[model samples]
Target: MTDQVEERVLSIFREKFHKPEVTIDSSFAELGIDSLDTIEALFEIEEEFGISIPDDAARSLNTFREVVAGVEKLLAEQRIANPPAAAGPDAAEEGR
Candidate 1:
C-alpha cells in the first residue's frame, strides 16, 4: 500500500512537471516547483486519492517524501474514520 501511494504521488508530480527523473527524495525547490505548483499538485493528489488536505498541512510539503508521508497520514486517518465492513458469513463467528 505504501508503494502504491508513493508511485501514484510520484507520477502526479512527474506528470505535473514533465520531469521523469522525479524521485521520492526529490525536493520541491530542487525540482523548480514553487508553492503554487505544489498547491496545484496537491489538488491533483486530492482528486486522484479522494482525500482532502488542509491548507496548513499542504503548505508544509517541501519534499517528495514529505508529500508521500502526508498522503499516507491522510489515508491512515481515512481508514480509521471509515473502516471496511465485514463481508463473510463467518464474520460474526470470527468476532467471537
Candidate 2:
C-alpha cells in the first residue's frame, strides 16, 4: 500500500510540474514547483485519496513521503474504527 501511495503521488508531481524525475524524497520547495503547483497537488491528493488534510498539518509536510505517511495514518485510524467483515471457517467461532 505504501508503494501504491508513493507511485500515485509521484505521478501527481510529474503530471502537474512536468518533472518526471521528481522523487518521493524530493523536497517540495527544491523541486522548483511554485506555490500554485503545490496547492494543486494538495487538492489532487485530497480528491484522489478522499482524505482531508487540515491547513496546519498540510503546511508541515515538506516531502511526498510525509504526505503519504499522513494519508496512511488517517487510513489506519479509519480502519481500526470500522474493521472489515469477518470470514473463513473460524469466523463464527471467533465471533463467539
TM-score of every model versus the real structure: 0.88, 0.79
For residues 1-96, write the lDDT of model 1, one tens digit per residue.
Answer: 999999999999998899999999999998899989999999999999999999999887899999999999999999777765574445656877
Best by TM-score: 1
Q: List clash counts for every candidate, in order.
A: 0, 0
TM-score of predicted structure 1: 0.88
User: What's the true lDDT of residue 14 in model 2?
Assistant: 89
Per-candidate RMSD, Å: 3.1, 3.4
What candidate 2 gets wrong by more than 4 Å, as runs, is 85-96
Please, what are the lDDT tens digits per residue for candidate 2 over residues 1-96? 889988987898888888988887888889877666777898898888877778888778888888778888877776676566584335557888
